[model samples]
Target: LDFSIDELAGNVATGADTLSIALCKVSAPTKEPWLTLSYDEWICVLKGRVLVHHAEGTLEAKAGETIFVSKGERFRPEFPDAGTEYLPVCLPAFRPDRCIREDESDATVGQQVNDMHAKLQVAEVLYHMCSKEDWEKSKADNAAYFPPMFDKDGFTHATSVPSLLLTVANNFYQS
Candidate 1:
């Protein structure tokens, strides 16, 4: 019931690749890359409008309207109106491979998504999964070593037991 939309971005909430449903909020007018899907997709707009450009031409859908993109249809989605909220459902889910984006060549939405996913996955693996890299870093660090993301993260994770600090650099941070 309580989950982050960012946590769902570039990833699925269902944990199943067969299907995915996500609510997307676009606060600013933004444009997305041309995407060719391997799965059928339905996008229902909840607020503002969405502009989709395809080979045939362009299609415009506003609030309360729904747009369907069949498999293999290539298109670019744009949110011309700020504060656009929409729900996108994908049949067979939306993997990076399933969503072939043409903007990977540049630092576009696809690249940004991949980058975000990489950072999130790294954090998950290093913190939750306890990778050897974290072990080495934690072991070698004698002083209060905050990771590179400490500033943005605002706090460091610490252990309840001082002796177990070797096992974890930072945990259970309370600010």
Candidate 2:
């Protein structure tokens, strides 16, 4: 697909049940007032840093960090130090039908970014790597694929393993 920068765009991802993927480049002195409703967002910081002002708190995200912005939250993301490049994923997908934007005057001011879940960043990476293709394909096929909420060891009945050799081999190779 082709990509273009629109002068009229809010520089934010807002949509519903629709998945929008874009490699965004955010620069300093850029703060856009925006809000979303139909879906939540999981933003992965690939380069530089950016700040997100939300109802719960404000946060600063640098390279190698990921942030989740829930739906219906009044938020405005900006880059104060240099610029940043990142990948943003919207749950259920970002559709214009779900986004709710506030007036530019109501945007958050001088807020500090505070992330509560940074460790989940690793899991997000693994999850996307494993399911990104499936997600992309499932969207086209009209199928649904969601990750399990709990590990089998914690919630499911135990099953006997026919062979521990494969497990050992896989573990050694992974390590």
Clashes of each: 3, 13
What are the TM-scores, per candidate, against the unseen true structure? 0.58, 0.47
- Stretches of candidate 1 above 4 Å error? 1-11, 104-108, 115-175
In candidate 1 the C-alpha lDDT for residue 150 amounts to 66
**Cα lDDT for residue 116, candidate 2:** 14
Local accuracy of candidate 2 as per-residue lDDT tens digits, 92-137: 5443445665546633321211111111121111112224776687
* Tens digits of per-residue lDDT for model 1, 41-86: 8888889998989999999989999999999999998888767888
CA shift at 40, candidate 2, in angstroms? 1.3
